[model samples]
Target chain A: MSMTHWQAAFAARIARDEPQWLAPMRAAAMTSFNALGFPTTALEDWNYTSLSSIAEVPFTVGASASSTTVADLTPYMINAEWPTIVLLNGSYSPSLSSLDSIPAGMLVMDLAQATREQPALMQQHFGTVATSEHAMTSMNTGLMQDGVFVHVPKHVESETPIHILHVSDAAAAMSAKFPRTLIVAEAFAKATVLESFVGMADVAYFTNHVAEVVVGEHATITHTKIQRESDLATHVSTTEVHQARNSHYVNFSMAMGSKLSRTNVYTVLDGDGGGVTLNGLYLGKGTQHTDHQTRIEHAQPNCFSRELYKGVLDDASHAVFNGKVYVHPIAQKTDGKQSNHTLLLSPDARIDTKPQLEIFADDVRCTHGATVGRMDEAGLFYMKSRGVPAETARRLLTYAFAADVLETIENETVKQALEQLTLERYAGSGNNTAHAAREH
Target chain B: MLEISNLTATAGEKDILKGINLTVNAGEVHAIMGPNGSGKSTLAQVLAGHPSYEVTGGTVHFEGEDLLELEPEERAHKGVFLAFQYPIEIPGVSNAYFLRSAYNAMRVARGGEEVDPMEFLDVMEEKLKIVEMDDAMLARSVNMGFSGGEKKRNEILQMAVLEPKLAILDETDSGLDIDALRVVAEGVNKLRRPDNAAIVVTHYQRLLNYIIPDFVHVLAGGRIIRSGGKELALELEEKGYDWLLQEALA
Candidate 1:
């Protein structure tokens, strides 16, 4: 069984002399993961995605790396603007990382170091934000190896973004990485964290990552995740967030690579006058399958939430988006809006979208919808009739579709990089790009 | 020069245009006035190579080459333009960008150099003034959130940029007020030259008053039943289309 394979593998790792406070938590997570097992289509949340393919592949935790150099990773770096923390095959790579001028009262180190140095702080916030309800989150909790932990003290806004790069070093054998991240922002603090995943193409690997974020009162946080794993890899990521009073939180998850990927994000506005925005962009091509599931919970009054997820699907690819906005009965004057838009570029592409809104408060306002539309034929013809070629017209419309979501990004450095990546995706897709218009 | 002989086209198993014959020389404007369902717009779209219409029997020779054999953009590159009856709204693409791309494409299609955005802005500013449009309009998405008058004016702006040899204005006066109609018509008049021609298709003589046509023809039953001088539009304007339809039947 899949449960026995993971349990026996992780038993050896945790058997090492670790912190007593963390040992029981991992054991309980293992128990829950074993009981829940892997989700199937019979379950409502897992209806559109199947794990049979991932279940068949043999996955090992924290496998050793295979000669990955810094030069090989330069293509994935964000270039001089920010400090980077590098992880190679789920292990901290200090030789590849560059961290300078770290602020006081802030911690930017591996989870192992935090467990040893700041055990009390780790005990207070590590497992508090994440729950082991989902099987995959439980799996990450039980077997997660070395990952980064970031903590910002009150009113110490980060001047630049902090980059976290996760690189998979797999050769021949199917390696697995259970990366765990815990971030905490004190009251009135502001920070932006960029999590980027990069790996080799056609390498069979598994990356199950879980990130837990907590924002104190009046704090603001911008958490961005860029998942560019190998096309032959299986990526399942879950992010859980909780915000305090008068806080603001934003989650931007862009998935452009992987054979099968699923991103599950859950946010709760626990404090009055708090706001949250959940934004995502997915580009699915070939036989890739991408799924996004988001849930926003407004538990307090006068809170606001906006969620927008857009997907572009081509070839025989499939995309699924399920967004839910829930307002509690006592949460009066709450405002929430959710929208999902998908553009189908080929006849074989398929999309399934569902926007669910549950509002129990009579004074609250909530609206949600989903749209699956093809490229505008009349618009394309109009552009073509103006002398723009049909092929360039198609690319223009597709680029416009992606830019709609990218333009809303708040960070300039990240936004420009995303725009460049989107253009590269388009140029790479048109195998006959020799005919593409390069006249300026 | 443009010439069409016995052109017949169908839209989804029904003939929208049947046996349409017309010709326009350089520096000439031929106005085709027809009643509703008389296939006026179909003729315009067919000439511009719209794929929705199937040309079953037709031979359109634009400057002595078969125009129907080319794609829509190819036809546009060959100096065939259609000012749409309803300009489509394309969100997320600015008006100036769309215009520059179209203009550069037309240039490159005929073996000319493509202009950069900064270089094309000079040309665009001149044309925008003709349509009395603001620079803000050029920055917004094409036709998105634009009023009817603004959309019509944008069509003229594109025309002034491309400077097509054979321009087909399809019902350009449908949704415009008088002031906007004046702006659009004046822009067309300014773009007219000795080497280019235009076909003004409308249902009323009001537009004809601004842009005087050299030849006015009445279309009925999918054919040009009557062809006369510009005075024909004034006569039809005063009497409506009933007498013309009855005369065609007789």
Candidate 2:
């Protein structure tokens, strides 16, 4: 079958028995997806990562069960403090999840259940943040069957983080899992949510996911998305965040997984004094490829946005970071800064970074910078002279290099945990700590 | 405790130290006075096994062991300390953390027990008082954005913590005022024990007034040309190295 046949098949599957309001929206999204097709390197946004692997996957959309359990995916769940909500093959599995101390007025249930019980609220926010412009997001909306829904009432604050663990374990079946997460924080509310993606070992699968977050007026939200999939899997993730007046949002993305992965993070400051921070760290090893395309729009005046993304590329892996900040003509007093830095660990590794600022306002402070280089030899030698093994010395120096970005994380425990994990990965990639100190 | 015989060192084919011979015994303080490029700092770095300097035809013995055969950190673990002229700035590494790591590395080398965090903090607090440094500096990254006097005081603080047997101070008195000079000298004097020795490498007699030395030697062109009592430092300060060089050549 041709590409148009696959698109038609996806649209036909979603049109049957769907809600009347969502049916027309799904058809519109399918038309946009057909027009866009799959983005190629000719497009500046998809320059480094290719979509051939995702396009070639032979699969059908729907929720299906597999034999994999939570015990089999324990190593990927790095954060044990947060209660886990495991999703097997795109459907929520309560038997494999542990939710004990959730706050009052907060909902963590399946998307279908939320739609059935609170149709009005679900209809108001679902598919609102993720528009129909992007093709992958359209594909996700066209094929999504089951996902996680979270809602926090006005003025309620959650003390602990909410974790949604999405695992694709359909090893025997050729399938595509589209896990959707919709989070709405009411006015004056505070919450933190983490989404982690995992897959079965040695499995060939495709995952198209979307997470839409809506922050009400004067609310605060902190979100983290960690994607670590099987080496043979192909994945595409898109996060759409909308902020109201005087609200604050912080989103951190760490992508260190999959054979081919592309993530799009777009934020809109819809009201005045709304602020956002987008920070990311990506690690690409072997022949893996990763790309991140982010957009932050200052629709109203007096809004502030800052973005910093860093990557460490080794072997023949490639990484791309494209960030754009747009300020409306009347959005005066806007402050925006975007910086992307990459550390090339091997001669064959590659990185492409572009920081674009389109400010129509006359009075604004906007700046961007990009840097890509090797490690500092002087810093390495200084550590080695202190009897730290050369391998350990390099590790310590690299840790220091990345510490500037990691230290900005407000939570000390999370910051330290990620630092330790990054160090272990650095060690596993042949840092040679045994002979580091011998040179001194 | 240490002996250097016919030592010659060079940097980039330029001779810095030429045929120098000196002996430092236990319970003694030897002060080497010289002008700029008189090889005072080169001697200390050579003894500490700095990589930039090439030692040609030199025999260094520390407590009857071949000192040149070991690395700089090994020399440090063997009770030899060099107070650097310029302490390096290590960002993201705390002062207390770096000191504890160095202390434990030394302790492990000598088959001694490592100090826990509480014990280490206690020892650090007690030693910090001698150098007049507050606990706030210990909490910060090592030597980052520190003043000249503060950096010098931090070096003395590290010495007090390590408690090395042989200490070499190279130009430690150059960037200090009167008050800082007295505090640094007092800290050094407090670290001195009967079994420990120190080599004060300087170009002026001002430091010797604060910390008295048993012997004062004149080093010119990498070799010691004159040896005298503590009064020799006074003579060199009265008439600069130019007068001494003229007399030695004559």
Candidate 3:
């Protein structure tokens, strides 16, 4: 389809019953999307990732979400009782969501419901943290229908985490889903939110997702996004965060599926004494292409940011990691460090890692480094000499390379689940070699 | 238990071991004392199937099985171990974890039931004492950030756990303090049995004082130039190898 057709479909989707406040925002975003269109390989950011495959598919848009049952969602759920909110084809499914366990004064509702009931709150923060800088973000903002809206009131610490599950069923094949999530945490509040994107079938589809997070003063938020789409799917997600004074935010993204996937995590430390950590782990196999682009803007003084992304590519897979840390002139005492390391298991596997640091402050301390290497031959031979089979040795070393990123996760339950997944993906071959060793 | 007839090998374009012949019987510890660049370590590596060395001409038999035809892990499973001159560090894999995996792999390959973690821990504790290693070392990454003595001790600890029939110590005494040398030699001495043997390759005879080899061979120019009893090691220690090389040339 051409850009005009995409714009016409967006206009038809927005002509329905949307609030008056969202009308102008949608119009501006639609104009931006029209002007930008789909990014091409000519752009520096998209130079390594091609969108020709995604653009060739005639995706059906503006359709009602396919009906999905609980059985179809069980495979994607990490915790079934964690005040879960499920989105089918980017639209909220009340039959699948279970929000009864949510704490009092903590609001968790669908985006459409929030626009109707909490219009004031939605109007103030929506489309504020995330700008229409990229075509995917603009298209998602203009075309989004329903996603979860979470608001943790001031000083209301949520003990149980909130699970936002996105499942695209078999009926969603040859279609597009734009998922939008906005999370606002009030002052002195603490919460952990996990967003999981999964697909139920082997059909090809496109997922354009955007999430805006606002962290209030002295608040803390732990956000995790796990992208396990179908092997033939295209996934593009952008997480834009704004942190307040003395607030802390950390994001952990794990990408293991999708034939073509790109995730951009951008954060701005707008308040003094704030800190942010963007850590990611990507495992690519079987000709898959995974890209992670992150930027941390230290806009305030006395802020610290750390970013570490590790990738393991096998077979003919390719991975790209581009991370930058930007510090403003007035942001003195800014401590920023970023590094990207990749391990290529096969000679055909490739990785392009670039760690950049742009600092205007003279007194700030910033450092960036990147390394791309193959498996350690000496280490492999050492293991085999100790009686470990060649295949098992490779699995153990691969798992070890990806295990340190799991340490970045603070939640034990989520950490364990991801640990098991990593083990099964890398080390478990009929027998659990590394898992059995860790059982002691 | 082990025989190598006319073994010739090369590393890269250089001949490392040329026309070497040796025989190791059960319950015997043979000391191979050689000068620098004399193929002592190469012989040990070839016996354990180090891929760096290409065996151009050799026939090695271990308990009547063709040792040269097996891979490194298969050689390990058949009770052959080589204590590396410099053990490589494997980050993120704990010492205990590596040992357990290696132990279980050998057991499973031999058609035996795998020992559980608890059972393995019991066996590990017994072997750890032989190397005088603390429990904290077991949890650390293999050979990473370890002291020189600690690395050698870890090698011995593995040998103790694996219980190989033929243990080739390649310069095991290099870069060791007097106390560490004694401890390493004592660990090797304690693990010796009537049915298993060892080949100690070193530059000096200081290690043989504790391990007490039954025979000593002087290797020069990729061949065994001389062979004698353990007293030959002491004589070489006092007289040095210059006279021996001159006598062999004469």
List TM-score (chain A only) for every prediction: 0.95, 0.92, 0.97
Q: Which of the numbered candidates is closest to the native, going by highest lDDT?
A: 3
- Against the true two-chain complex, what DockQ does each candidate achieve? 0.51, 0.18, 0.60
For candidate 3, lDDT tens digit of each residue in B30-147?
Answer: 9999899999999998888888899999799999999999999999999999999999998778898899889999999889988877798899888988988897898888998999
Q: Provide the global lDDT of candidate 3 against the true structure.
A: 0.89
Query: Which docking category, incorrect, acceptable, medium or high, applies to candidate 3?
Result: medium
Better of 1 and 2 by lDDT: 1
Candidate 3, B20: how far from true, in Å?
1.6
TM per candidate, chain B: 0.98, 0.98, 0.99
Looking at model 3 chain B, report the run of 10 residues with the lowest lDDT sum.
B109-118
True contacts kept of each: 0.60, 0.10, 0.58
Score residue A55 of candidate 2 by CA lDDT.
71
lDDT digits (tens) for residues A158-259 of candidate 3: 767899998887877888889899999999999999999988889788899999999999999899999999999999999999999999999999999899
Residues A1-440 of candidate 2: C-alpha lDDT, one tens digit per residue: 43665675675677557677777777787777777877777776776777865675567665454677667867756565567788887777888887776777788878878888878889999989998377788877876777888899999998677889888765524667888999999999998888888766667677889999999999988888878777777889999999999999998888888888888889999999999999988888999888898999999999999899988888999988999899999889999989998988899999988788898999999999999989766555444344334565566555555555665666555666566656667745443232121111
Model 1: colliding residue pairs: none
The regions of model 3 sitting more than 4 angstroms off are: A62-67, A103-105, A433-440
Residue A151 CA displacement from its true place in model 1, Å: 1.6
